[model samples]
Target: MSFKQPLKAGAVIATLDVGSSKIACFIAQMTDDEGGFEIVGVGHQASQGVKSGIIIDINLAESAIAHSVHAAEKMASRVIKGYPLRDVVLAVPATSSESHFVDAHVQMMRQNVTENDVRRALAKAQVKAQKEDREIVHTIPVDYVLDGHRGIQNPYGMSGQLMDIDIHMLDADFAHLKHISQCTEQNHLDIVSLCSSPYAAGLSTLVDDEIELGSIVIDMGAGVTSYAVFQSGRLLFAGGVPVGGQHITSDIAHGLTTSLADAERLKTLYGSALATISDEHEYIDVPMVGEQNARGEQHVTRALLINIIQARLEEIFEMVRQGLEDSGVEASICRRVVLTGGASLMPSIPELAQKILGKQVRCAQTLKVKGLPDATSGPAFAVSMGLISYYTQRPYEMPMEIASYGESKSFAERFKGWFKENW
Candidate 1:
């Protein structure tokens, strides 16, 4: 029942990522040695009833989740009918997520600072961050100032008269969280923890140097493009833009007079974020929309398709640049940008990102996760794999309290049910 404990050797962990394009499930076992973890099973299905990373149709979303979980279970040789899967770590996109800074000054009672003093300061900051309707998803202590000396990583057992602490907290829409929880519950899964998608993707892709030197990780998914800022091995900011690969697909469909499926195929095969002179000679057969009488096929230059994709992608990068500026993080810290996710696979996307974002840009694939299939080990799977990495590296102490669904059931009743099932 304790979520704070790390996954021990031989312990099993499951992660579920519900994105606008797909629902991914992963099952892994902690290795006995430093090999870390092994992917026992993996499953993914085309996302349905979800739009812009939000669940719209509960039944359809639940069915998609169930199918994904079942597929992973079959691969792992675990059957849900006999031994039910109970808990899962969920990855959620930060749609409309906001960041806030909370500062607290605590007068130390004793001569030396202890764990209690640090805890008290964090608790006071959390109190100040409390809002009526918002749910705080992450409460990270960015820096600790002990007796006017700042940037102390850990203040415990230090001698100080006063302790000043600054915390970065991320808050999400409560209604969105409730809907996600309900959908997972419908599939008989209890959410053990939640991690932001962009943050997770960064963890899975960025190298240690990239994190320490400060960088931005942009996850361009099907329906939403999310980014996270990291510096000194901690997440500084997270935000998302509604436009993503799906929007590009729709634009291609409209611009070329083709169906959605055909547009997607073309986007995958011939899409490029930057156009060259040679593109004019490269032609693609585009299907005409609503043409039923032998006028279905049309020839279009690849340059046109690249133009359409470039327009939308430029806008996306511009939005990201503006978001970073609004956050007030210096451009120097975010000098490097790492692009990931499905949409980032388009040719020359890195070049386009560099031109628009004005940063050194590179497309990243997911870091190797033990036993992960080569086909499934790509940038698109970064978030799901990062969930596993997060669990393995998380501290023993739990930080923020997850917001409840505001149910009418009593605490005793809920605890009893959870205990009975898990114990």
Candidate 2:
């Protein structure tokens, strides 16, 4: 099927991020200025039926999605009895996403490069990137080589006999994506586009300097921590580790013998990745598990809580380090590390990340998007805000119907035919 038409100026666009810990929705209107959009409404609810960034119960997921959407609609002052939200940009997890590099070349017809030539090269690369059970989510042209000269960003007006392009393609499990689509459809929402979690996070947190100089964005979410590498203003690699903030909470609950709710409260109030000298003297009240009243409350030193939190966070960063190495992009991630998400709010996380990841680390919230409320401007909302930014940027390819060229035709001949037919 052909892709949906791009949003017009002043058109309302909604984005939904079905994260492992929370389901968030944002409604915004596109502006006339390029890369300019404003948030009009926002809604979020505690995530249920989702674990490690994947949906486990469709019914519960659907309800949570519906609730968040309705809340956003109400805030926007736009409500409908039937299908109020028709289209929404969705964010998918990077748990099973894979990246593949493909190269394609086209022979010039009149010694001048054209958009058609780029499209043909991209189509060829796309064809080669196909897998048996996976679907392509992103196809980004990283660099262009023309006549042996490399690093060409705009080769449209350049002259070259052979145009070679290196494309980075991201693919994910088809069944997992299909299930996500099903859950959205249950709420009468049409999937406008599916963006990877890491890609969205990078878009939201990375600045122009970081993108140009190369950097890594770590989205430390509740149930999963995902990272993506950006170089030359494009995403180069994306990966995720299943461990996240929720795991630490679980560990605290288990170690302290408390309820999950109380453990979460304690983690948010006093959690730290590194213990200080004063932690031993600081005392906190802990409600023992299966306790009926205040009699079951226990006092534990802050040192004990920090120990549990620190152990889990250290393991998470270690896994992140290994995942980056396994991705083979460790060398490219040289500029700095930017951490976002609810878990990143921990006081000592940036310090721990710098010590373990061996780079300068900074905890970042979402960049300033106009009309975004202060309440929703933290790291926890990075993915959702990034979805809006992605919609405004519209970095993906536009779906087009191409005319078929005969098998006997050469590359130049097919390029001419496709170019004439389309443009």
Candidate 3:
């Protein structure tokens, strides 16, 4: 089952991000052999098919996916006809994803820690992950504890009768994965892998040192904010808040009596999460729908708009703080918080997040790529770039699918094929 042969040079792969606010498509070719990769095609479009971080209407989702992918293909001077681009590495938000830690102990059957022992321990951990009414999406091995020796990175080639493992498994609600699968399948695409949004963002933005020591990656999307804690190159905590940039837009629309579209444009061009009366002298031209006043009502001061957006942004970060606290991971460990996604572009968002999270925060930007537009290299492209980087590096583990024959049935087998639906 191993793809041992060297992949062809200039092998092109595609990544699709069906985000809350936008659907982004990326196509890149492997370069410099296996060490470096380069981008060749990219496309993005405003999403009308999704809402609240999940795909609700399959038809709309399919159209949106096709639009983004086609544009990228055109840019690459290629056409992915039919199901040529079926397999892909997909990213999903944490709103519907769940995670838990499981510990397993195996006797090793009078032998040292062997491959079978590792499999058995993983089986126990998987069973524990499915104890609740959810389906397992990912099973990650954190560390192994063999006999009295703890923190053993590899238990194999060591003499120990008792094999113990600490596993970090994630599960998503059945309905959530099914809807996503349907949306992609209807569009003639097959999800080869389902990646956590935070993990996907971390793939490109996080460096080796940051992951080894500790860092928090916060992916701020339109309708949801996803966070991940990485220590020793493993995902320690993952979760998301139900609120995001959409909330800020809603607040501005309510406070200023403007349409949602106008509020969004204002937020992108002039809104800041931190407001100061000293900076209130500047005024912005607001599009008026046949409304005018001698007091200059059509033009509004920037401070008022900032004040409204700031309130919502503050609440969202507070909820993120609460989520970190609830995960039992000390906030002190995350001295560096990297902000990515569309909402991270706000002028003073990094400063605002640092003030609230008590950590050094900065916007996440893409790196080491060519043929990409300047606008696509900013913090907003972190997830899209990460998706590309993920396919290039192939870092994450794939889900183990049960074989048809000669496969031992474990307690975790009950959830196999659970996600299949006609849709």
Candidate 4:
């Protein structure tokens, strides 16, 4: 899909972040100040009928979407008159998608390059992206090559005999996208665009220097953990693991024989990924799954909880480490890592990530946007806020039909044919 349209000035923008554990909606408006985004409404509900980035029950998903959007719309209506929320930018989960790099070169007719020449190069890469069973989510430009220069940022006006482009393409399962689309459409909201969770987290959490100088964003949601690499202010890599905080909660629940709700509460209030000897001295309450009396509750050392949490977190970070190794980016550029998303809120997650990923890790919040509450200033709202911020930037790609059908395409490639049909 083409991200050619940008957020309009003084226009109201809505965002929906659908996840395994929670669904959140934000109704915001663009202000006169450049890059200003003021929130008019907000709503969130415990997500149902979605697991690991796939829709399991359309009715439940639609109901959840409706609840979140309507709550935000009601709040927004109180703030602005005559403007009803009708469209939203959705955050696509990276767990249900695949990210790959495509390189294509165009021989420049003239030594001086033009924008058309750059388009031609990207178009060649797009042709390789077509497949019937999958749909393109984001086609991001990673780096440009001028002749043999490997890291040229842009070759728009430069002189080069050959222009090579490295583009990052994210394709999601076509059926999965259709189900999500149906849920949102059922809620009377139009999905204007879809931004991957990793890109959204990076956009909302990373600073200017981190984006340009190179940084990795690890977004730990309830049901999925996604990581993105950014360099020169562009997305270089993105991938995800199905295991997330929810899995940790399940571990706590199963090991302690407690309810899922109680398990979540414990994880939220007292979970830690870095256990210490001192934790054994501290005690917390654990309620049994089916308890009627005080006898159902038991005392457990914090160390026990920490142990369970740490084990799952270690596994998560190990997977992230492996993903980064396979993501095609070099170790030198993976020096800085930023932790975001709701699951990243767990204590010592960054510490554990640093230890496991062997990179400098820090927790970050929503940056470069305005009018967010203190609660949303953390990493949890990174995706929703980034969905709102997506309008401030310009991204170019082909139309929504960036696919070639009626053939045996393996769930996934075709940008070259689009160029011929369009230009």
The lDDT values for all models are 0.79, 0.79, 0.73, 0.78
The TM-score between candidate 1 and the true structure equals 0.90
Runs in model 4 with CA error above 4 Å?
1-5, 33-35, 109-111, 366-368, 397-423
TM-score per prediction, in order, is 0.90, 0.90, 0.87, 0.89
Cα deviation of 371 in candidate 4 (Å)? 2.8
Which 10 consecutive positions of candidate 4 have the poorest summed lDDT?
399-408
Q: Tens digits of per-residue lDDT for model 1 on 1-423? A: 123446677777789999999999998888863328888888999998899898889889889998998888778764223446556777878774677777888998799887666666665665566665665567677788998999998787789999998777777776676777777776777766667889889989999999988999999999999999998788888888888999999999999989999899999999999999999999999989877655789999999999999999999999988988888655456789999899999999999999888789999955687778787898999999988877667532224331121121232233234323432
Q: Over all chains combined, what TM-score does candidate 3 have? A: 0.87
Q: Which has the higher TM-score value, candidate number 1 or candidate number 3? A: 1
TM-score of 4: 0.89
- lDDT, model 3: 0.73
Candidate 2 lDDT tens digits, 106-126: 887767897777766776665
Off by over 4 Å in 1: 1-5, 33-35, 78-83, 292-294, 396-423
Mark the 10 consecutive residues where model 2 has the least summed lDDT.
Answer: 398-407
Worst-scoring 10-residue span by lDDT in model 3 = 398-407
- Candidate 3 lDDT, tens digit per residue, 1-423? 121222357666677788888888877766766646667778788886687678788788878888887777777664323325545667777888876877878887656666666766666556555645566666667788887788887677688888778777777776776776776666566565566788788877888888888899999889889998888777777899878888898888788877788788888888998987765898987654335544434678999889898888888889998999998765577688989888888889999999889998878866557777786787666777777665555433334431111133553244434433442
Query: If both were scored by TM-score, which would come out higher, candidate 2 or candidate 3?
Result: 2
Clashing pairs in 2: none
Runs in model 3 deviating more than 4 A are: 1-11, 32-36, 79-83, 109-116, 131-133, 288-297, 391-396, 401-423
